[model samples]
Target chain A: MTSQDLFAEISIQAEDFSLADEVALLEKDNLTDGAVVTFTGRVRNNNNGNSVTSLTLEHYPGMTEKSLAKIINQAKEQWQIGRVKVIHRIGELHIGEQIVFVGVTSKHRQDAFAANEFIMDYLKVKAPFWKKEQITEAGKTSENWLDAKTGDTDKAELWS
Target chain B: MIKIVFFAALREQLDCAELSLSADDVKTVNEVKQRLSDRNSQWRQTFSNASLLSAVNHDMVAGDHLVKSGDEVAFFPPVTGG
Candidate 1:
């Protein structure tokens, strides 16, 4: 395996992640990187005028990791990147909790920024994780499966 | 037998997690889906959803993809995680 491949990591877990710790680890042993970029997605309290109390994420066990790895590998091929880390939290997550993270390190700001965004966009549309939000409307709480946004699909297709 | 699995909302709607069905006559993913939906009205409703997504052995594919005796097929709604 190439040394660059060793710097990449992907985590799919039920526990929350520390952004600072993740970034530090991504930056570890970096000698040529001049830029690092990271993105985090959080659980919001509301969606489409409903009060979202929490989100429960479910995924196809083996497929989720394979799909995520495919996205990261795509990014690696598209950019001259050094390090990549992707962490996505599953199970129940409350409002204001972090849900996903994508971090990339590269020698140039353009590569780092573009690769990070590229990974996030593709991950949104391609990953096998499904989020079910507990939304309250008129004092009735119901679990609603979020529909894929056309805008998100468009954004991901932009990379193609 | 071919193993079939459901995830997320589709699993809840179908009231099934996983099941094994004889693969004797089913040759494609679409055929398996057609047989599953024939179980009852609830199963029919969920599988007939136009937006349902599916995978064969962890790789996403269309309804016409062929299946084998031991192949695992999964069905679900569109992915929403970022």
Candidate 2:
């Protein structure tokens, strides 16, 4: 099958996210035993002991969606996935704001959990998003942001 | 001419996303990269980065792969998508 059929529930946005709606949509398919697992990643106000006030995320426009689509297709190939939803936010964001969400529905909890973890691991290492953290300090001002975590690469490698 | 594109951190660091190089004697992605590397030291550093990825005609490919004029060659860091 082509990539469009597999990416029925993929979104990359700049607005705030709704986790409940995402989970509900992921569980919409039939022949499911009602097992759904989700993982939500939020933006924290600190990075490497620095107090971050906000984060500015940048990404490659056309390439970002293409890469995410491939990652979702890979997940579908590995497991008996019913429905999957992935939402990633770009642009400026504050602390505690939702950054990403992954919802997986399957016949059993094992598959759901596995899919959730798989999506997250792959996203961390494969997504085209980059973050720049703006730090607020008492006396000095410094902005710091790093590349996607190397630990994430290790995690994704384990699945391969 | 060959159209080469850059993305993400590579784009940010290089200050431009698209470049046109003379396709004469350029037959592969490696040849295109080498032509670019000869232009400036920055291009060399970007290409020398081992983690970078290459794409030809919108499909990811190895550097040694053959290419032709008007081919779209893109280079970027390893994908980090979920």
Candidate 3:
């Protein structure tokens, strides 16, 4: 196995990210990594039966990056993973636009898959990010902050 | 002084994003909430909500967490990100 340093590859920005470029960066100069798993979350056109016009993500500045680093470190402790990259976009996002991405590389497929899921799950709850949705329907429009669902919390708890 | 911040819905509802309070006046996270709630009816109602969550120095903590000068305390609703 090729020795590697544990690092937190995180980006919190308003700009979009290229998945191909991100994956390539993860795979570049890494001969030990045999499996790479990636997950991308996108804004949907409809949510809870309402037409979602757009989504605005808000996050704590200093804490957001720290939380992501902590999460990546936790994943490293649980699995034999290397080069985990997490990118979450903030500010206004249109329907079908990407919101977040989680990529994990490992020597085996099982470790890669498990670490990818673990990072996403922990990011949902542990990270201090929130989403606000704008809805338009029948010539009327409304905006509200999306509440964190109990199901999401429960899902995160399952990993613990 | 300690910095107190609100995020997301809490920020909108309270019409406040950030504020500073003297550390001598508040010793714990709960004390800060109580002092803020005492400001007005709207503030009282918002802070009184049981679902409100808080963090001190960027890490989630319970109400009894002791705070010090220059520390940042944030309150917000549960996170809704993936």
Residue-wise lDDT of candidate 1 within A1-160, one digit each (tens)? Answer: 5545637788999999999999888777786788989999999999888899999998888898899888888998899998989999999999999999999999899999999999999988888998899988898989889988989989999899
Question: Model 3, which residues run further than 4 Å from truth?
Answer: none
**lDDT, candidate 2, A19-125, per-residue tens:** 77776666554444467788888888777788888887776666667777787888888987777788888888889989888887777889778988988887787
**Runs off by more than 4 Å, candidate 1:** A1-3
Candidate 3 structure quality by residue, lDDT tens digits, A1-160: 2458864589999999999999998898888889989999999998889899999999999899989998898899999997889999999999999999999999999999999999999899989999999999898989989978888889889998
- The candidate maximizing TM-score is 3
TM-score of each: 0.95, 0.85, 0.97
* Candidate 3 displacement at residue A160 in angstroms: 0.9
**Fraction of native Cα contacts reproduced by each candidate:** 0.87, 0.42, 0.77
In model 2, which regions exceed 4 Å deviation?
A1-7, A29-33, B57-60, B78-82
Ranking of predictions according to DockQ? 3, 1, 2
Tens digits of per-residue lDDT for model 2 on B38-69? 87998788778887878776566888999888
lDDT (C-alpha) at residue A91 in model 1: 94
As for DockQ, the candidate ahead, 1 or 3, is 3
Docking class of 1: high
DockQ of each: 0.85, 0.43, 0.86
Better of 1 and 3 by TM-score: 3
